[model samples]
Target: MHQVAPDRSWPLFDVAATRRIEQAAQAALPPFTLMQRAGLATARLALAIAPHARRIWIACGPGNNGGDGLEAATHLAAWGKEAVVTLAGDPAALPADAKRAWERLRQAGLDLAPAPPHDCDLCIDALLGIGAARPLQGGLAAAAQAMAGVGRPVLAIDVPSGLHADTGAGLAVRATHTLALLTLKPGLFTAGGRDAAGQVWFDDLEVPAGPEAPCALLAGPPLAQPRLHASHKGSYGDVAVIGGAPGMAGAALLAASAALHAGAGRVYLAPLDPAAARLAPGLPELMLRDWSSLPLPSLAVACGCGGGTAVADVLPQVLPQAASLVLDADALNAVAAQADLQALLRARSQRSLPTVLTPHPLEAARLLGTSTPAVQADRLAAAQALAARYACVVVLKGSGTVIAAPGQPPAINPTGSARLATGGTGDVLAGWIAALLAHGLPAFEAGQAAVFRHGQLADRWPAGEPLVAGALAARAGG
Candidate 1:
């Protein structure tokens, strides 16, 4: 069994992929080998979590997931812990592996409950797994609700029952900890997975999850390369912030300021309005440049900040030749509306230019021509779709900012807060991403770091103080 953390890279699997791995591992290993390992792991985790508990409630189902629970009950019994089990369906209805486990539990005299285990120390939820076809109902629903009401921790096997293994967006058991057997699921890292499967612990059951198509990913910690003591400003590279149309100059300035603070050697602003030169009083370091005079690919370009409608005109040239690109707000909207621009964005994917798109749900809906509710409902799926369509790294921003690469597993970011809900925050995020790109971080890392840090600032904002966009950007160092 391995551990998963916010700062580490890990594999994420979908239902089909996970099933294939289990099948392949079963075929290669002895019959019941994986089940034994799963049961052992589950038993160990239960004991560790609720060591002094007098009773364990095992909710049995009709599949292999249930068999895993049965096997664990046997272990718990052997260890002298009182085990009570309630069957949702007849034992004869169990699948082959589950049937064997049911027989083992029966032989051990461990199946003792028709009623719920009152005041049990731990509720082992084994009612369903990736194979669940629909929502939990009947005895299963009552049992899940009962488990939740107990106020004790529930340990789920394989997955929280009823959750969509691929999307993590379905009715699920409120498990305090899930011993994900054989493979780590992508759902557990995104959507409702984070809350449904608390503090996920994987066993892998000694099963090898071979190479397959991954639907999403968990990013590892950022690297540990040290900066040279004698490094100069030129070492970090320059960044040019483009997009502040007339009244939205603050957006461009926010991004410029972020890049400057995030270690960019220098920062420039190219505004849609000619008067940006005289407007920014507090920003003495930001040099204003005309769109025509903006530097090319040598500098990372952050486009569409406060762009309003003028972003459409600037994208044609910038798409073909920016050093690196981070598109936000109106720039993303412009690409969504124009087929010509969409083709250019797609071409960037082929060019392998480091491109990132940071779009909240509404902006994402504009890009995909879908409803905002659809995007928000399955954020991981939406982010991955945008990445595949544009062939660029995509940041589907919202409660859980999903970072998806062209052909890599998406990382569901675990940082940020409600404080970032105000305006200008996205602009600050765009700038931070631009700074990372300017400093030569890959498109994937650049987006991940910026989104993570942006939300982190919001999460750690001073309790009594207001957390506006400008102040949020200033806390980038934290």
Candidate 2:
């Protein structure tokens, strides 16, 4: 069993792939061996959670997920713990492995026809797994709901029953602790995954990954640190914010401020709105530069912060010269509309320059020539598709902000909340990521770290504290 952390990435597997892996694991091991391991692990976890409780309710389903619960009941009974196993299925119609587990539980004298004991401390939700593709209704759904209505903790097996393992969608079981078995699931970190599966724990069942490709990654821990004794203002590197045409100066300036606060030694703004040079009254440190005079390929460039229509004409130049770039906001909209500029942006791949594109659902839809619903349906896949098409790192913003590389397993950022839905937050994120890129972080890592930090700042911000876009920028890099 491996505990997921940031420095190490957990390999993700899809439902079909994971089942194949499970079968392969079973091929080498004895019959019902994996189930026994699962049961033992579940019991150990339950004991640790509610040691003094008088009654332990194990809600069993019709599938193998239920069989695992039955096996757990047998073990708990053997250990002299008060185990109550309730089943929602006929005993004769279980899958082969599950049938064997049920037989073993019956042989061990641990099967219950009625509902589990009501006076429970922690209910084990073994009702569903990846197999549940639709909304849970009827007896099982009602039982799961009844368990939820009780103000107690829940230990879900494998996944939170109803959640889609790949997309993290659907009606999900609200679990306090989830035992992620065999392989870490990608769904647990994205979409409704984080909310449904809380305080995740992994037990790979001593199974080897073998020669299979992972579907996603856990996004473990910060790979490196920024605070060093020898670091100086120049040591961290500089970032230049370009965009904020006319009315949207605050957007461009927000990125600049975020970059400055997020460990960039200095931040320069090259605003498209010339009249407002020396604007952003409160941010005295942001030095203004005209779009043409500012040095490119020297410092990191955060472009497209409210660039609007003006960004279209300048991409021909920015795409060629900017060595390290982050494209976001209306700039992506401009390139999506202009084929020549799209080709120019594509040319960045040949230059080997680092460019990151931050696009929300609609912007990503425009770039992909698809609809927003398609993008939202499978955010990781959409982001990966965009990254490969543009030959740049892509940050698909929304629930479960997916950070995808050109051809790699995407990382689903586990942090962030609805509070970040406010406007100008994306601008702040772009600047912070640019700052990380400027400070010598890889494009993908810079994006993931900046996103994690951006959300972390929001998560930790004190109550009554204003979480405005400007304030968000000010909280970056720390």
Candidate 3:
């Protein structure tokens, strides 16, 4: 078993694809071979997690998942550990493979009880696997509930019971560690999977997951590109940030600060509010200018961090003239509400100008004419739909932020945490992407790199340090 991390690329298969792989592998292998491998893998992980434990409680359901538990009990008993089992389903009503496993466990003289024993060092949750169509109820519910409060290390087989293998929804057992069988699941990394599964371990049951089309990819760490020794300030490129109306000048300045720190050759801040400060005392490198004075067609533009309603008026000029653009925050809202702006955004593709859209759940919902819940139910579909409809690279931000581009598979970012939930971090991300675009990366590549680095800063932040937006922006591209 291997731990999942962002340093390596991993293919993420949905439920349907994983099921096909399981069926194909079962057919090719000998009878009970997969079950034996699964049980052995589960037993080995349990021992490794709690080697000093004297008692192991294995909860078994009525399906094939139960069979894997039964197989594990036999091995644990042979290894001189006290392996106790609780059955939530009738033995006679079990599936064929499960029935065989039950007979084998019974023949091995292992103790099996109808209810969970009060005392056990560790709990192995084999109550449910990939297929959980309904909510847990009756004895299964009780077992799952008991596992949650057991105050010990819980090793879940395949997946935590009740979690939707594809969507990562539904109530699930809280496992301290999970062993994924056959293939890695997309749900385990996105949605509720991160909290429910804990540290995910992959066993694959010694079976190869064939070449099925994956729904998404677990994005890997970005490659390092060393700067040339002869580089100068002009060696990068110019970036213009247009936003910050009235009271929100800080938002535009945050983006400008981020662009400057992220290696933009020249950074210009064009605040819509006339009373905005002409210079940042702390970051004097940012050049403040009027919105109309900017040479839009000549430089990479990052628009709408705090533009508010004022951004709508400038979209007509910014959308058509900018050589490469990043439309974020209020600009996304403005485009979603106005058909004229939407048409102009779509027209950029015809001119072969690159554009990127960064929207949180609400902004994305506004663009799609749906609710935030609807957009979050299937983040990949929502992101891809937005990218396809607008003909631009889209970054749908939230837990496991998704980056989708037209004609490419979506990627779920593995970095980042709740520390980035502050107010102006999105603005910082916008400027970071704009800086990369100015440094000569494609829209998709720039978004991917910036988003990854943006989250990495939060992940590496000192534990006691408060992660504010300004600090986050300053820490980018390090």
Candidate 4:
């Protein structure tokens, strides 16, 4: 058994693949061996998590999940712990394994009750596993609700009761700790899974999954690149940020500052409002230029930080001229609102020019012609659709920010926290990605690397100090 963390990459399987693995494991092992292993693992983890607790409530359902709980109850009773079991399903209607487990519990003199025992320190939820598809109802629903409301730590046997293993949808059990059996599901790391399954643990039950392709990947930490002594400033390449129409000049300047701090060789800032501050006084290195003066064909261009309506006028030129482009903020909105711009954006794929689109939920909704809730319902699917529609890498920015590209399995970023929820951080991310693009990384890799670093800044921010956007940009290099 091991704990799940963001330091290493993990293969995420869907419900179908996990079922296949389970079946194969059961066929190879002796009868009830898997359940016994699961039971033992659960008991050990429970004891480890709360060793001093005298009473542990084990909630059992009608399936194999409940069987594991029954087996655990027997072991706990034999070990001198007061294990109280509240069974939600009919004993006669249980599956073969669960029925056998019930017999074992009865033989050990452990009686099953209909309601949870009071004054319990820990609750083990074995009500519903990954097979749950419908709304939680009946006795199982009541038990799950009690467990969630009890305010104590909950140890879920497998995937949370109601969360969809494939899409991370549905009203799921909010477990304090979840033990993923056999394989890790993608839902545990993305969408609503992160909040639902707190402090996730993984125990394969000694069952090795056979050769099956993973459905998604959990993105890990990025490698550090060492600058060579022989390298010059020009070796890093140029990046130009074009946005800041009228009142939103701060947005464009934030991107420029981030690009500079992220190691861009030469950074240029072009504002849609020609009267916008010509120079970023604090950072004298940033060059202020007119949009027409930019050699878009040679530099990596980050557009739409705050382009407003003025960005629409320049998109036609930027779309065709920039060597590599990152369309963000208002630029993404402009593309979503105009079919001509969308056509031009899609045409870049045929020319083999790299492009990345960064959009929050609302911008993504506008682009896809759907509501924000619809886009967030299944973030992976939404991001994948955007990538396919534009034939480019799509970074759907939010919790568990998803990175998707054409013909590639999506990656769920594990870094970042609520500290990034403040304004201007999105602008910082756009500049960070633009810097990586200028460094010549592929669009997908650039998105992942930049996002990883950008979030790492927030994750490692000093506590008690406010995490504003300017400080975040400066710390992108730190």
Estimate every model's Cα lDDT from 0 to 1: 0.84, 0.84, 0.89, 0.88
Q: What is the C-alpha lDDT profile of model 2 across 87-138, one tens digit per residue? A: 7777788787778878887898766758656577888888887778688888
Residue-level lDDT of model 3, residues 180-297, one tens digit each, is 8888887777677777888888888877777788888888877775789999978889999999998889899899899999999999999988888554536778888888989998
Structural similarity to truth (TM-score) of each candidate: 0.88, 0.91, 0.96, 0.96
Instruction: Write down the TM-score for model 4.
Output: 0.96
Which of the predicted structures, 1 or 4, would earn the higher lDDT when compared with the native? 4
Candidate 2 regions with alpha-carbon error over 4 angstroms: 1-7, 115-119, 225-235, 463-466
Q: In model 4, where do residues sit more than 4 Å from their true spots? A: 279-281
Candidate 1 clashes between residue pairs 3 or more apart in a chain or in different chains: 7-220, 7-221, 8-219, 8-220, 8-221, 9-220, 217-409, 217-410, 297-323, 416-455
Tell me the lDDT of model 2 at 457.
Answer: 83
> Native-vs-model 2 lDDT?
0.84
Tens digits of lDDT, candidate 4, 142-225 = 998998877888888887777777777778889889888888988887778877788889998898778978888889887676
Candidate 3 global TM-score: 0.96
lDDT of 1 at 230: 94
* RMSD after CA superposition, every candidate: 3.0, 2.6, 1.7, 1.6
Order of candidate numbers by TM-score, starting with the best: 4, 3, 2, 1
CA-RMSD of model 2? 2.6
Indicate the TM-score of model 1: 0.88
Model 3: how far is 263 from its true place, Å? 1.3
